[model samples]
Target: MSTTTTTTTKQGHPPGLYLLFATEMWERFSYYGMRAIFVLYLTQALLLDKNVATDDYYGSYTGLVYLTPLIGGYVSDRYWGNRRSILVGGLIMALGQLLMFISASFYQNFSVSHNVMLLGLLALIVGNGFFKPNISTMVGQLYPEGDSRRDSAYTIFYMGINLGAFFSPIICGFLGDTGNPADFRWGFLAACAGMVVSIITFELLKNKYLITPEGGAIGGTPEKVAQIEDNTPKRSISENIGWAIGALVLAVAFFYGANIDLIGSFIFSLSIIAPLYIILDKSLNREEKERISVIYIAAFFVIAFWAAFEQAGTSLTFFADEQTDRVVFGKEIPASAFNSINAIFIVLLAPIISIIWVQLAKKGLEPASPAKQAFGLLFLSIGYLVIAFGVKDLNPNVKVSIMWLTSLYFLHTIGELCLSPISLSMVNKLAPPRFAALLMGVWFLSTAAANKLSGTLGALYPDEKLIAAGKIPSIFGFQITNLYEFFMVFVVFAGVASLCLFLLSFRMKKMMHGRG
Candidate 1:
């Protein structure tokens, strides 16, 4: 390959879309499989002190998961190509799954030994970091600007993600929740199957349908590649070793129990993406900076939306498992299956949402990006309020019905429809062409921040003791108890955020000029 192909599927994209489709499908399955059990394992299996407030740990863990893509994206953009990084990540993740499998099998055998499982989780984190960002970038590579299929392509891609989520809980849950979920290695094995399927699917499609002929993996003959290398910038061997050593140290720290916060601490510390743009401004004119400025504003609003919505993995999941009765057809459902409800809703509604966007845009009535996001926050605020009201006045002797949780997911799904996909399009539209991928990275960083905060916010939920411990004491004039008071904090916070965002619409739109 002289110059690696970048795709631009205009009217109809290539069949390679299916390749990414299947690959992402399984990858998400594995991810959801692991996720399905993460909180459950922590609260029920590992028996950590859930009441002691583990939100920081969970927030840091999930946050870091999103954050690592920055490192992975940078590596792919600067040194290795997307294809190689994806392959490496897949293999490493497979091993991590194997480690998890071993950990489960031997949980009682090792009993107190945390090293065996901790190391495996660390590997998965690094592997996922390497894999996630690069793959998304490849999807963009498959279609150029103005490709009619591009937006539809992404919507379809998201569908693949949900497809995995849809099946994972049912399939893995059946295996995992058997007699005892805590020590079941079968769940880990199911997750491993997902990674393997993803790796194999992508590997086969790398040369065929997935990539076009502009910028992609480089595997040219020695004579062609060798000549270009002589003029390339060179770094000393010691510098290379220093970088390697740093990466190794990070890996070590990641494996430790609590130090895993190092991921969130480090990634959160990188919220200064603006400085990088400032430095590059010497090469850019006035128009580019204004364009990039819009991206940052949108990125900020999205962080708030995701932070609230992502509670599905943290607080909401906890509520489902602990406070709500998840019986369906007279049998109790695994709490994680509730997690899939969003994906299932997305799978069913994404096409309809896409159609609505098209019709709205055609009629010159498309909502401003800021408005869409603000409305999304409003949807989330309402979702939380629904739960707040639904769970109120419970007699303290019984669990709430599953219907309340289901309704909450439905509202969150609506908010998700408004915010998530639209934001992706908005960011791509607002970013200047040259820094497209970098700005996308920034957008992903915002998601990382919100997801991280999702974990942090989770700690606010009232555990059994928190209620019984009288933490919800009546303050002066008001009385609040159980999860109701805790959720009210978010309800008010989100409602205010939505209002502020709505008011900011005119200013935010002006920042975008005519971009979207």
Candidate 2:
């Protein structure tokens, strides 16, 4: 119940920040390492059709991964609390990675391997629901209210995420993506090991460092919820259940009407309904409603950004594997290894961006969070534009320079620097303390929608085989005959979304009151 600020070091941040950093780093290592090779495993080892692999399985798995965070966030807010949720989630994810290792190990036995892989994906999706939101919410708790350092702290935390991501592809790709199906188990096993390390680190450190500035434990059980009085009217348990059932019915109706697959429908529907449910709560005042509306609005725009950015694991990997000139110094780079490029760029640039934000704050020149995200979308569009031009007029059979793809990732990294961490900090700043973890989950819900769309777009990757089969690839009725057009799809989506968000940024900032 103490109101004192948490202790800090010479670095101007709490020591617990590093602890959470290490924990999140290893979890991302586990997740990204497995992801770096998942598509390849489906296409090469399992010999599934590329479209089916990306559009159905890969998209569903990744989308569901983000979707389940809603459940985890709600559970943490209502019952388990952040620390316990993280531990449980980390353990399940480790098991999921271990199952993936088994799945890769049994690749020769197609049925067993495929079934086990599905089970593994399920575990990971559920586990991530618990782990992802809680960890992010805790980052904000490390600082007291009105702390200007929060944004910089998130940027530093984001660096840890990228640091793990940077290494995962290199290490996992080296071990598993060596053109031999039998070797993938080693990469998955490495991911499993990373998850185990993450769990152990959190268990050892949470009590010691993961605390509020006032020396109170952060993310404790519901019994230890913050002592701040709530004047808002509380909903009855029956009313909450009624809302849940109503949302489920609406989601099912959307699934049938949307013509997309079941998982996609569920993700997209919940992304909309979940936030509406929160906003409609009778307990929220006018100010809280406006702030939450800003979160929802930003989340809507974020969908477009992630839908385009997430292609790294799908269509982009295909480009690297088949169209890019990967040979260098007499060795061929694994397609999965290219996934590390964005991560490496983030590692190199996060500190600089962090400094830039801090300096801008000092001068009172800092853009509102929404404006930063608008610039993010702009950078993303430009990244795609760069690659679109790079591939224009190039022969289908001829590989382009690796520099083209490298340049695209560089711009996307800048876009991510602008948006992702800023959004996290914004949610932390704007969310009611009682709803902190749940609101973070709501933010990730946008990512779930984006990832699902990423898979759908990835399926449109203009494969020659599909074209030869008379199945022309298109999005919204426009044909994608080659890489040029495919890349432009992203350019247009991000560009339009960026311009629109920029125009609305001022209004959204006003909704934040003085918090902006």
Candidate 3:
């Protein structure tokens, strides 16, 4: 492997970090702004059933969103450089937002608007695939190998993400959630503006700021892959054809999941198959295979963590809208405003947690990445338990205090702090440099599966049937009529996954080959 000498920069971080930060912040603003009202739009604007909206459309859209990153990362690594991919992705996403604005503007024409919304989602999904992984890969490239600043840089970057997230709902929700149901186009237009800002920031500053202290640009595609080609045999045409066919089949299945009842099972099946395909590939050496094994193991745990965590955008949003009391000081706040709480907590806590990691590392007390992720799952489980308790035996006619939902988001935010950034860094560190973006995309497979699971689980949220009549529903003989019963499913799922991951941490760490 060719090694680059470490160059010093101010504050132990390069200036490129801030540029990427601003770029990601604005991108996130555009994304979360759209997400904040997506479910509400499905239900109110599109006039879909709430249960179906969350279960099918929301689940399928989100699952596909994460799924496209695999293609984006591969194309960027093999054809487009990171910078070009990011620019193209940002522009596409901006266009997507514009399409969504048109969708909202044409809300009265249900057919035209619905088709437009689908097109917008496709654009956003394709664009995000290109933008998300490459930018994060660029952040890792900014620091040389073995630099401690990488984690802190990501935390700071994460804060940028949340800062955008923190404000998006307030801005977009306020504009979108006007008492008039037909005015959502304003919110989507605001999202489009955010995307424009993101692209402009990236374009204007990349050459000036996206470089090492030594003044060489970073994240351009390398001319040759020195490390990966060694001892790897090239695939034959038939083998390549087979792989293409397989990918086509997976794509067909994913699209079918929108209307099919069996998508959850298909996603779970793909979760296993996708990692195995990577691990068993002859192109990878033993070291790469072993390192990827850690990602695969981590991916399983990822499924559980995100399946619960992602409730924020769907089921939890509904809960906030339907069950949670949003009144404070004689004012009824919009339920969608609660979507910002997780971001607010992330913004508030990211710096604190970054410092904690630094201090712990100085004392040689920092937990291994796997152990930290286990803690994340544990916290996720605890968050569910909190809400489960808060809503136990609650009346349907009266709304529960908003604190229940707020507290849940707070706990989930801490769990996210422990898991998300660590996992991102881990993938970059472990992946073969040649396939860094591809592996990052692979890492998102867990999220794709988890989102599908989340949608399926969201289908189980207290339906009007249960809420109105206080009837208990059963899943595999376990009764879940009340809010407590419904949430306990996540408590058990996350709690058990946390325990399993905790047990596997030592072994997974060993498989990491000292990369940590």
Candidate 4:
């Protein structure tokens, strides 16, 4: 396994890190830009029911976005390798964003616009699968084993993600939400422009900046690309044909779900199967299996953390749009602008948190990765609790102050600092070399499940049915009704999960077999 360059010229870090940083930054700009507007476009522009948008379309789109990475990661690991996968994926995604722009250009044609939107979404989903997991893998590949900087490197990388996220909503929302319903397509067009910038930036700088200390290109296949192959394959051409047909069938199923329904089920099944397929590979040594077990355990906790955290694009967006008072200086602020709050906080806090981790490590006081993750969940729960309390006496006809949501985002950003980047570093460190990108995809599978679950939970946002029935929806005995009640559910759910994870941390660290 050729992991790192042998050459050593120590200053701060390698150039490849910043190159990937810039690439991922623009990619996130495109992604988060689209996300900032998607639900609003569905509910406000298309005039779909809010419940359907959250429960079905939003859930399916985000879920499939993560699900396809399983295919992309596997194919990259087996054949395409990371650089080629990213190049191809970037092109496809840029085209996908263009298709979305076309969808918006035909905004007046209801049937045609909707069909084009579906096609655009399909392209984005396919493109992202190839782009998301592989790029993160390249980051880890730049560093050698047991390097302390890996964690901070990912944190720095995460800031690049937030840097793009912070500006995108401001730009995209300004263009799309210009107080005119017809102008919403402009946001999608802006997203297309972001994708174009992302790929072009990558292509221009990758050769110069994306290299190790020894000047070795990262993400390229170690051997000739044509020689890439699976460890074992059936010699029969019919078997290969049969597998190709199966892939086509799966894609068709995704298309049907994208068009009509049942995407959640497909994603749930794939989430289980993809990781299991990796873990059961006969080539993994005993230590690798144990390390993988740790990833699964951590992923379970991550699902809990993200299920609540990911609501920024779903429930929180709805809250900001419909329930939060956006008046500042007597002018109403755009709801999508609120999405940038989390990113803004991340931009401000990430470097501070990165420094804190290093300082703590120097003093031998830094928490283990699992413990840090538990703390992340704890902060997430506290964030929800803070908002839940503020909304306890809220009037239905009136909106709460923006401070409440801003404060919630602040806490969530702190929690993210602890959990999200750490989890990425954990996967990078623990996964076997051959399975690197594939395991990264599996790590994202946790987020896929969380994204879908967040959407499902978003559906429980005290809609007409629950309000009309005069009964709050109770899950695990927590009643949910108004903004306060709905928010309380997450408080209890994440709080309990965080506590459980904290209890399990000691055992989990032991299971890491000195890796932690």
Q: TM-score: which candidate is best?
A: 2
Work out the TM-score per prediction.
Answer: 0.84, 0.96, 0.93, 0.91
- lDDT tens per residue, model 3, 366-412: 98899999999999999999999998988867789888998999999
Instruction: Report how far residue 332 has shifted in candidate 1, in Å.
Output: 1.5
Tell me the alpha-carbon RMSD of every candidate: 5.7, 2.0, 3.1, 4.0
Model 1, residue pairs in steric clash: 5-212, 5-213, 5-214, 6-214, 6-215, 16-209
Report, for every candidate in turn, its global Cα lDDT versus the true structure: 0.71, 0.91, 0.85, 0.83
User: What's model 2's TM-score?
Assistant: 0.96
Q: Which stretches of candidate 1 lie above 4 Å from their native place? A: 1-10, 51-53, 109-113, 179-183, 213-264, 273-281, 432-434, 466-481
Better of 2 and 4 by TM-score: 2
Number of clashing pairs per prediction, in order: 6, 2, 1, 0
Pairs that collide in candidate 2 are: 5-213, 6-213
lDDT of 2: 0.91
3 or 4: which has the higher lDDT?
Answer: 3
lDDT tens digits, residue span 1-516, model 4 = 334344342336777788888888888888888888888888777787776888787887887888778788988987788888998898888888888778777777879878988998899999999999999998987776776678878998998999999999988888886666677788888888888888888888887877655567877764543342355332367755654565456645655765424676566666666676677766677888989988988898888898899888888998998889999999988898888999999999998988898899889998888999999999999999999998888877788889999999999999999999989998898888877888888888888888888888887787655468685555667666678888988898899999998899888888788777
What would the per-residue lDDT of candidate 2 be over residues 307-403, giving only the tens digit for each residue? 9999999999999999999999999899999999999999988888878977888899989999999999999999999999999998889999999
Residue pairs with clashing backbones, model 4: none
List the lowest-lDDT window of 10 residues for candidate 2. Answer: 1-10
Q: If both were scored by lDDT, which would come out higher, candidate 1 or candidate 3? A: 3
TM-score of 3: 0.93
| Candidate 4 lowest-lDDT run of ten | 1-10
Residue by residue across 409-469, what tens digits does model 1's lDDT show? 8888888888776676676666654344456667778888888767666666666666676
